[model samples]
Target chain A: MEISELKITIVGLGLIGGSFSMALRELKPKKLWAVDINQDVLKMAETQGIIDRGFLKPNIPLKNSDVVIISLYPEQTVNFIKNNLNNFKRGAVITDTTGIKDKILTEINNFIRDDLEFIGGHPMAGKEAMGFEFASAEIFKGANYILTPTDKNKEENIKLIEKIVMGIGCKNLIKISPKKHDEIIAYTSQMPHILALALVNSNHIDGLGLFVGDSFRAITRVANINARLWAELLIKNKDNILGQIKSFEDSLINIKKSVMEMDSDGLRRIFEKGSDMRDILWRL
Target chain B: MEISELKITIVGLGLIGGSFSMALRELKPKKLWAVDINQDVLKMAETQGIIDRGFLKPNIPLKNSDVVIISLYPEQTVNFIKNNLNNFKRGAVITDTTGIKDKILTEINNFIRDDLEFIGGHPMAGKEAMGFEFASAEIFKGANYILTPTDKNKEENIKLIEKIVMGIGCKNLIKISPKKHDEIIAYTSQMPHILALALVNSNHIDGLGLFVGDSFRAITRVANINARLWAELLIKNKDNILGQIKSFEDSLINIKKSVMEMDSDGLRRIFEKGSDMRDILWRL
Candidate 1:
């Protein structure tokens, strides 16, 4: 299909969904359909011309969409697809924007229409603060997007989803199994959030003004978190996060032991190792 | 002493020292004397017009200085003062800029000339990239200047140091006991560095381009650390850092346990608490 003739439907008008809608607008789709449960969000999106049409509930026109992007919270995303699987057009390339993938992919794949396809997608980018108010199309610029497609996924469906992902301005489109994506995310994304939260909660931050510098600000910047969304993400990816925490805790304990023992050489080794590892980013 | 009529001596010529010399230039003292062990650094400062006179070694002219500031690494700061206590002019207010203080303060207070007063000062600001080339007078523009003065310190001497701190554009001058400063710094400064180092060291960061995001970058920005300087600091403030690590690890364990148990409510509570604590910085 020509890019301009594609009918694209984006469900959930939150940050990711709204931003994705704006980005997909650049493709000049024939019909841009937005589905949001919040009436205010739907009204604002429609009034702002963010979509050709907005729905408080799924409607018949959504059934004609050539592509559907579910951008709800992880659990809601699976339930939405399960309930509305038959509403989607036959051979519609369906994808989702959720941080966790294993459960959602499995559940959707279990009951998805055989004619349609469900590809698990995650944009590895987010604002520490949530909601549609802060949404911007630039948020996904140069960000990594992972697509987790199981053996059940059709080749053409995967290709169509990839085209949409590229059209949305994602820098890297990595193809990984859902299980591997979870493990990598647990280490890179989830562990850092846990560390930031723990660092903030462990301190009496009342007098932090007198003591803080750039380092504290940099480390705790993530502490200005979307608490509800993160709590859901953490709970959904419990096992991988737990394992990542264990790996992180072991490293922490080793350094703590060195500091306690006044082993300057040992402590230096750890800092040097960390500096070396972090330098990889600069090299890249 | 009148501000401009006073002769000021600055020892050591690294980042803090170089920046201080440049900042003190605004006072236009009678003679801004610079002493550095490295003759090359002394020559460079004189050529740059950062100082009126350069001294390769402590000289008789240094004895006539009304105010002396020692800016060096923690251990070096203590050693410099111990060796040159007699070199400072009688009744001159002496101060040193070093992160850790209890040891430096006690040693200086133990064997000091009765006429000369020693005050411990820490300008709580720095850049991760170190060197005289990177130093700037603007670094102290809005940074807190902490003065840890013991009972042996004269009130008049503390006031004199405060004037110098203000003249150099420090936004605030806070008086804290040396013991309290170390404890607070362990949580505010040292703990964050430890966490950053741990986070960097804990991961296989080689392929980080594929998994990194803004949050990861924020938390690890401090990972471009001065490894040797930080190693020395971690060792010098060992006891306080250990205590902080223990407190932080307790919070981490609580979080890890909640994630392991899939207790979303408990995890939410922790995130909410952290968000609340972190919000204080924004309010300030």
Candidate 2:
């Protein structure tokens, strides 16, 4: 089906959902509807002309939409899908913007309707701020969108979601297994977040404002994070995050040992290795 | 004593020195000179009209200038001052741009002549890239410049240095004791660099480029560091850095334990502390 002919519904009007609505509006879908718990948010999105209609409940919109993009917290997303499984339109393509995929996919696989296609998606774009007020369409301009498609999804449905991912201005479309997405995200996203939180909490000095440079600012940029959301994320992906943290701890210990022993050569070697790897990663 | 009438000479035309030269050129000093082992850098400065004269050796410029700013590696800065103790013009105000102040000031105190004033200065601004080729006057714009002044430093000389610091576009002039400077830097500057290097080294994944988001990029931006310089920095301030690393390790362990045990409340509390602290710091 052509993108313009599809009726799209975004479930949740927070940062990601609002942003998805704003970005998808540019694609000129036949009808863009949003279902959010907050009536004010729905009213605001409607007033902004980003959505054709707004529903406070999912039942009516879910039954009418051709595409549904769920953008809620991990637990809430699963509950929303489970509670309203019968409400979705027949043969609709459902996708999500949750951080983790393996658990969600596993749970959804057990009870998902055979007619509907559920493609798990994770958009690698966000800001430290939350809510619909802070949302912007440009957030996904240069982002990477990962899609975890199982055998239950048809090729045409996957292609349709890819078209929407591109329509949102994402730079890359990575298709990986649900397990692989969780593992990589544990390293690239969750572990870094934990480290940032730790770094901020480790500060014992006062009036550090005078001494900090760009390095300190950049390293701690994500330290001002969403506590509840991140706590849920960290606990949900516990095993993978723990493994990444252990690897990070080992690396920190090795570097700390070199510093303690005054081993200049060892420190130099480790730093060079890091520098080389960073250069290669960024260049690629 | 006006900035326009002062004869200024900058030694070691690397990133900091080169940038200093460019920024100071706007003040229209009586004569601005630069000295470096790399004749190409000196020639480039001369061609760009950032300096009136370029010296292969510091002897001539040091003897003629009323203000001298030394920008070199920590050890090199000390050695240059010690070797050229007699070369500086009488009553010339000498300053340096080094990361650590206490050790360098202690060494210089043992042999520094009383006729000249040597006020230690550390501009908290830099990039991962090094050398004069990458230097820009804008590097100091809105950056913090720290001045470590002791009883030996005359009030007039300190005031003069403050003018130059502000004239070069630094947002703040922080005057603190050398001991206090090093202690704060370990937590604010050195610790973040170590964390960045460790974060980069911990990445054992082969294709992280596709998976990384803005958080990972920001946290590890300093990973592409100058190894030799950072090694010297981390080792010279060994005790303070070790103390900071230990504190950070404790913080990480606490968060890790919470995640491991699935203690959502514990994780939320820790993350809230970090987030609130960061908000306060950035707001201040």
DockQ winner among the candidates?
Answer: 2
Off by over 4 Å in 2: A47-49, B46-49
Which digits, one per residue and each the tens of the lDDT, describe model 2 over residues B1-284? 78999999999889999999999999899999998999988998999999999999899999999999999988898999999999999999999998999998999888988898889999988876789988899999998899999999889999999999999999999999888888899987887778887877888776665886787788878888788988988888888899899999999999999999999999999999998987777765
Write down the TM-score for model 1.
Answer: 0.96
Worst 10 residues of 1 chain B by lDDT: B204-213
Candidate number achieving the greatest TM-score relative to the actual structure? 1
In model 1, what are the clashing residue pairs, if there are any?
A: none
Task: Give candidate 1 regions above 4 Å deviation.
Answer: none
lDDT of 2 at A188: 79
Candidate number with greatest lDDT: 2
Error of 2 at B202 (Å): 0.8
